[model samples]
Target: MEEVAVVTLEPWHPWPLVFPAIVLATGAVMTFTGHLRERRWVRDIGMVLVVGGGLAGLALLGLLSGSWDQAQRAEALVGLGYEQPTFSGGDGIVGGAPGVIDFHAQRDGELVVGRLVPLGDAQWQVVEGFRDSQPKDSGT
Candidate 1:
């Protein structure tokens, strides 16, 4: 009898890309319908909705851009360490296990970080480090 181990690594999801489109569409619908009526409150509500939606859309776009930039950084990090020997004790370990290698880049002056961990023995894989910060920076 023989035993084998299987490991899975999932790619990063870019959800922020769709968020702004949803918000903008909803706001446009509200604004268009409200403009058809003469009620002051209706128009006010519509304007508010439109403004809020625009802000939300912009925020989501920023997040999407940042995420995209981080993805590049993660790829670079993985390539840089792909051939390096796994260190037993160093910046890439946590609780005695093979720790993650964090790659960081600055987008619009804000630091974006990603993590790469050893997926068994095949290759250094990108681990879902954090949405906005590194694991160690998260105080975990």
Candidate 2:
């Protein structure tokens, strides 16, 4: 039997993208607290922060998405030791065109949609990755 080498990836770094979400979430918490306390100033400030943070954070997500994709590709290539390899990805949309895909390859690559299943007590596996994550005719 051929042995398949396991490529281990370090812990994922999500801090860059999490900070904005935290800010937006903070706005919500403050808003709720202010409303409960009957503090108009806090409520108003919270509203402003929520709206502003939501918009800004969403925009940042778009950028971060690209960055995340690049990083994933880089790491995978390093692990596989390939000069150019492609993985599934989607359009700017989270997981590609909403329910149409689970993930995308690049800005214009094929979209992949699938659900994860529990392989064991502490193990999970992606159905799509095991089945149809390969490039067909895109020549990626």
Candidate 3:
């Protein structure tokens, strides 16, 4: 009898983007209302809210930017024929079929490189390498 297992992966949540925007907007409104009412305490409270919201927003923005960068890198890799990309525990896997080829590339102390993985069985081998070539001319 063949055994089958179903694995489900959850989609990425976008609450980080929404939470900060909501907080910032609310804080701005509170600050504006407090200023209009000419209440020092209320104005201070609004300012505090604004600061908190701004910090939260900044944190979320950084996270979003990092995510976007990763996505762009992944897209580029895929475009370059890297298949079945997987990153786990500081290691990455790409392609699969026979056996797995694991390798890492890095430059300097701060410049990190993406890892390339090859897949195939023991008898078969897959390689991950890149070549520089000009784009083909596609007439508009």
Candidate 4:
């Protein structure tokens, strides 16, 4: 048995990320990301990072929406025009809670959230996808 999202939520090729989510699931991703974008003074979430990449986005969506999985991930990789993405394992500290971070390649420079929570006055970490995924340089 299989299921598919009616729309790809294709990035930037730019349309607001808020759209498909309306048809999908719930929680802070829809509520918080948009609010942070609206209230730019919020700094931690204000600078808003598009965590992970297209594959990453697909992963988050797959978890939240439940109707998506490997098939969607593969198609989304194509949609993003990324070839042969190697998916490493990522697990959240809290089960069902996604981690928010400072990477944007997943959304084609658009802001879609993978993690959302109260960043509460902590300094933000801006780690772009390539850097985050790269093995820490042995020399460093």
lDDT of each: 0.51, 0.52, 0.48, 0.36
State model 4's lDDT. Answer: 0.36
What are the per-residue Cα lDDT tens digits for candidate 4 across 21-58? 43232333543655757744443332233332333456
Q: Give RMSD to native, each candidate.
A: 14.7, 9.2, 13.3, 20.3
When 1 and 3 are scored with lDDT, the better candidate is 1
Off by over 4 Å in 2: 1-14, 68-140
Give the per-residue lDDT digits (tens) of candidate 2, residues 1-140.
Answer: 12223333233355675676777788898899999999988888888888888888778777776667456534543443334344444323343222211322321244333322323332323334334455569756
Better of 1 and 3 by TM-score: 3
Clashing pairs in 2: 88-104, 88-105, 89-104, 89-105, 90-104, 102-112, 102-113
Per-candidate TM equals 0.39, 0.40, 0.41, 0.26
lDDT of 1 by residue, 1-140 (tens): 11112223333455664665676676677677777775667667767767877788677676765565445544554444432212222254466555555544443445444455556543455443244342345556
Give the residue spans of candidate 3 off by over 4 A: 1-15, 64-127, 130-140
Count of clashing residue pairs in every prediction: 2, 7, 5, 4
Mark the 10 consecutive residues where model 4 has the least summed lDDT. 1-10
- Candidate 2, residue 38: Cα displacement in angstroms equals 2.1
Which lDDT value does model 2 have at 6? Answer: 36
For model 3, residues 50-138, the per-residue Cα lDDT tens digits are 88888987887778765763554444444444554443232333342212323223323222224333222212122334221335478
Winning candidate number (lDDT): 2
Q: Given candidate 4, what's the lDDT at residue 136?
A: 50
Q: Indicate the worst ten consecutive residues by lDDT in candidate 1.
A: 1-10
Looking at candidate 3, what is the lDDT of residue 32?
91
